[model samples]
Target: MNNIALSRWTMSYFVTSLAAFAIAQALMVLGYGFPQAAAAAPATLALVHIVALGWLSLLLCGALFQFVPVLTAHPLHSNSLPLPTLCCLIAGTLALVCGFLQLAGDIHTGPPCFVFAAVLLAAGFGLVLWNLGRTLWAARPLSVPARFVAAGLACLLAVLALGIVFALVLGGALTYGPALRLVHAGLAVHIAAGLGGWLTFTAMGVSYRLLAMFMLAPELDGRGTRLGLALGCGALAVAIVGGVAAIGMGVRTSRVLLIAGALALACLVFYGKDMVHLYRARKRRKIELNSKMAMLAQASLAAAVVLFLLSLALGRLGQLLPALVYLLAFGWLSGLGLAKLYKIVPFLTWLECYGPVLGKKPTPRVQDLVTEQGARKWFLLYFAAVWLGSAILLAGFAPLFRISAAAALFASGGIAFHLLRARLLLDVKPELRLPDGVRKPNILYSFSPKASLR
Candidate 1:
């Protein structure tokens, strides 16, 4: 597996994901050609799907394929699955995007596109979760983050199931009826499961390790760690399942559900605060760009929560809620996902190439795979674009929203390309490491001493 040239597949899929994002951006630019609130809905949805499914999911699949074995001290069930997963995701996303575009033009095509995309997405999601699941299941007594990821995969499955139902709605196969109470009631459940379940849980699971490693802090453990996990997992269940059930009962039940949602947000806040505090309390003073870029994402999420809660309190949800959702999905979720991938891709390349060669022969440090200084410029541009695009979103000009969407694609593409470029430039002598941008060493720190991964 180590000698299988996994780097090529990784780089290729990275390109595929970024290309989709760029195309989506270009489409928005051409579709609207002027900023307007009218295009915001489709535009935001397209952008969210592009970032989450195309860029982040592809990147994560590529990465975990390389590292899961290392983490578990076991070889993967099949080393070739990453390629197929990448292909399915890229193909599936394109179909869905086209379906969405056609549907937006007219209600007719929405259903077909939804079904097609759902099928493809399901295949891709299944491959990823299945592989990761098998690996983690075999590795016993997993660490907290590992357990979180194990749980996160469950949420991912729930999200995908709801997502299929959403597709059914688009396909005209279902409607709101007493018989199909599940469909109407399911939308709320879908959103909660998709938004709060898959996306948030997975991010938290990854962040628990990634943030600590980036900041040079120890991985969470003992009681404080247990509390964090318990709060996170418990709240996710309550808000998604319990809250959705409440909404099914009545309006009054719905309000109680909203409070449960509040508690979910509270869990997020504690998680965020703890991560920030961990970073600030770190022994390493010069934090890397990857870590710093994460702050912008965290800030976006913080603002999203505040705006959402404020809207809820002031009874202005109808007017302001869409904008808030946009901020959370694109600004917060997509942004952080992109920032981290810039580092993760190259690091994976390092492992696939140099991991086995470690200690036996002179080898490049993982940092040798990427240039930190180069990464800094792209992150700066990406964050700048995020703030600018978010501001345009707030102004409610639809054409401006389209433009912001374009900027986001360009910025995000730039970072992903930056990863490829970093890899190509790394043709240095063994042990002559290039400086990876603000590398937090702890993400992979849990490698068992007995493992041959290093």
Candidate 2:
């Protein structure tokens, strides 16, 4: 832990990501996408990009900026890169959203926003890969978590390349027959690579380390972890290859995709089993609120897998795909991200403020910076709303889905407020604060001078 350098721009990434999440939720509550429009509708595309690019990608980038070093026991290749990377990502996301709106005939902006968006996104993701890839490369024979991250980075590159081509086709910059065919057939592969390959794979890798650390459990170094990683990578590879072949060569790849999906499910089974073992083997007897809430996220993943398998069996997979996506995006990914942030924000705050003064003076424990009782309800409300919303969406009830989305929005707001409170040290005792000379950390930046703390 001592070897891990602080990521100065990570909090900025987190704050921006949360803002994007709020906007996405607000859009849901307003019925901007999906149930209100076709799944392939422009408005739906805009909303999905807001969640996927603006929220989840940024969140994942922030976490990686901080933890990649922790995983490899090496410093980041460059600390100067994250701020510029964040800027590019934010600009790209906004441009992409506008491009979607332009396609929907909502905004009549000229200049082909999709092209700009794709360029900016490619540059941003390229920087991320360069920085993290070098760091991982410097430490050869990577650990299990690091290997997962490496695989995810490769997927991110694939996602970027596919996305850029899609953007070009949509923006009228690419009208060649092959390009058009790729667009028509590559959507599934693009989505699967981004969501499953990049986001979920990276999250799985980070959780393998973070959950263990938080639980005081042994880090997994066994066959199940290895198998899961291999299968996950294999699944993504198969999906990409099959999709491309179906598009360009006019090949039948349904069986290939089916095999990929089966492998994905198997990957999940192994991961779930490992998580169970992780929890059972924990050295810490008392679980904190973060770990407790993460259980719901794990359960959401399980529920999603079960529902997906059932829908496929019933030949209703297409009908239930949106619900499954909702479950994955909000219930599993967002839920886990928020659960981890509950602890991470406070822990980072503690480290920044009290680390230098430790042993020299009295300081609050990391737990003292937050009140779990206040936050627990918000986590419960969030997961409950997500579950209800997914079910309602599956039932094709738009109005009820919006209502549940409002509940989710409310709960997310509460959770964000709690995280903000932790960041500001607002919940810490005044007596504890006065003796330690602790001050509120910057809410949206991490570049404050160390001298200011003194």
Candidate 3:
């Protein structure tokens, strides 16, 4: 197997994505976007897109660039792809945010701005899909991660196409008052595709491989993983098809959507059980801080699933919808990404700096490049604040909800600080190294049995 190293520029995704998260949190606390009273307000829409596209989407693209190659044993098609992808995303996101702000201000000019933003964002998505899709196409017989990622790219394509049409409607380029119903139905479908089909699917696929690598665990159960993927894809397809019917044919397929939701919940249960088995079968006795926090994130995902089903059953799904979004976005997606970043940034830094010097001199192990002790408290605080915020949002206590948002904002700040420090290799106390005579130093990120340290 060949060893593959990802682009150094992928770090751009880490820094910029976290910055966008901080901005979104601040907007929530300040009542600019994500206001408790007006869930569908323009500012709220802008904030959601920022988090979804600029933050989460960019982060996923960056990680996949690195890990896709790692999983497929094939290097990225182009190291240059990430830098341009970043440019397009940043520009498009800023334009979209501005358009939303204008709409919130009741400006007549908002529609045109939205159209322009749509064009830019579509271009960005086009580049990303082409790049990643090409890489996957070249590799024969995709791995599970590759399969999930390819599925995600497909969903992303659907998302962008729908978004462009949505933007056109808002821009008054399409005038069918009756067709506006389609927009409403499309909204829910869009969120489902973005969150469930794209983000959740990709995260699950990556975690299966990543957790095993980090924990020295047995490889994930192939049959179980494939089954979960199949279920999830089926669920997403039903939801998308039902949504299209509602939009194009003006048919409300609520029952179809409900079935999709049930299938999705089942998919989660399957993946969760597989994860538990993976943890139990691990060879490593000592679990790292990142993995510990990741388990919490996984728990949050499960909690979010339960909440969805309960809301649907009780006929209170609307009341609890925002809370579900909160749990999924911050608690599940952001939480896992943040926890993993603690390890990824440092490990990448170690590879770039210390890996070359291993035989020449005493060098730090991957674990020594970051201080887990310093980051654990922050992780705990972040999750606690997320839970509190989600509960407060569901309770319909406006002032209290804002307070919880503030707590989340502060906790996110702490996380950003720790991640930045790790990226910079600041305040890292090198652990004692083995002498040259004791053992041969392992190559970082290599697949060869002689090269792998873990």
Candidate 4:
């Protein structure tokens, strides 16, 4: 283990991200987004941003703040920056949501909110890129995981710049010819960059490292892994270039995007093969709950890919795209995140509250801080609801979709409660408690003033 210093604000990020996720699910249950309204409806846009910027982006940022050091054996440029970053992200997301509500005619606020949102989000993401980027750069010749993060950061910059343009255009601050054309045709490109390049690529990289660590499998740096990375990069490059070209030519769909999709699919195939190899080669005889839940998440990704191909073959790609996106966002990405947090929260809690007393006193194992048996049903329920909801949406049944969303929200709440239990050290046995002198950490933050593990 690297034994790096703890990230003081990571738990705060996790808490906020979970709250955002629950809010997004609540919106779904209330029929605020797709299937209830047009895919491009302002309410749907608000819901999407809540999931993207508020939930997944914040979660990823927190993970990276901790994970980058492990990958590079170096510290962040400055730990002080993350709290500020979190504040900016939260404030910006709220402003952006309100701006969208204004567009939906539910509020009367004007262009200033949009511009403020764009500025705040840019500042927040820019700080993240600077901190993590500098840490990776100092490591010199980077590992594959580090390379993935670097590429993802590049994609994030592109997404941020495009988002700024989008916000300005929506706020009527940009009426120039090119900006207007991009406003009309660039949404798909923005989605491709944000979801495909930034989120998926980063997730792929993080999962490669984390799965190996958790499974007791060898680190994979073979040709297959390399090829998968190359293909993913190629796909993103093609998508961005093709998207820009389409915007310039005043078109929406392009053969270039098709080529990009094909490359992305091939990348997924390689990634899937690597995952199979990891599982088959693992030394751990008994897989834990988190790994098991992660397998379901991987299965969700496979299902989404299969559905996409089928929809394309049946000439229903446009109609099915929203369902496919829902599967990716909720089933694959969010599912994987929730699964990992089930383990990570306890592990970090153990380190934060138990590490200093390890040699001097008895302590609980990390696993002692969580009850996998009690939590498993929630994981299962969450995935089931996500899959059922996607199917209902595909079948054009909005009411059933809302019901499924409610089920998912219930499952998510159950999962969050368990994570909170872990954070609070509620599951640790009385005999394994720290000695009288050692202070237990706060439920959602570290107790140490210096934020060092030792």
TM-scores across all candidates? Answer: 0.81, 0.97, 0.92, 0.97
Point to the candidate with the largest lDDT: 2
Question: Least lDDT summed over 10 consecutive residues: which range in candidate 2?
Answer: 445-454
- Colliding residue pairs in candidate 3: none
Off by over 4 Å in 3: 106-111, 176-181, 430-454
Worst lDDT run of 10 residues, candidate 3, spans 444-453
State the lDDT of candidate 4 residue by residue for 1-454, as single tens digits. 4457788898889999999999999988898887788999999999999999999999999999988887777777788999999999999999889889888889975557788899899999989999998999998788888788888898998899899999988876778999888878888889889999899889889888888877889988999899999999999988987788877887765687899999999999999999899888889879989999999999999999999999989999889999999999999999999999998888888877877777788887878999999999999999999999999989998878899999999999999999999988788887776666567777556665333332
Q: What is the per-residue lDDT of model 3 for residues 240-346, given as tens digits with 9 covering 90 to 100? A: 87777766776776777888998888889889998998789888889999899999999999999899889988999988998999999999999999888877776
lDDT of all predictions, in order shown?
0.64, 0.89, 0.78, 0.88
Which portions of model 4 miss their true places by more than 4 Å?
249-253, 448-454
Per-residue lDDT tens digits of candidate 2, residues 1-454?
4446668888999999999999999998888998888999999999999999999999999999988888887788999999999999999999899898889999875778999999999999999999999999998889999999998999899899999999988988889998898898778888888988899999999999999988989999899889999999899888876777777886666777788899999999999999999899999899999999899998999999999999999999889999999999999999999999998898888877776677788889889999999999999999999999999988898778899999999999999999999888889887776355555578876633331111
Residue 217 in model 3: lDDT: 88
Each candidate's number of clashing pairs is 16, 0, 0, 0
lDDT value, candidate 3, whole model: 0.78
**Residue 57 shift from truth in candidate 4, angstroms:** 0.6
- Model 3 per-residue lDDT at 152: 79
Query: How would you encode candidate 1's per-residue C-alpha lDDT over 237-324 as one tens digit per residue?
Result: 7756675566556433355457667667767766776777778777668877777788888888888888788878988875775577
How does model 2 score by TM-score? 0.97
Could you tell which candidate, 2 or 3, scores higher by TM-score? 2
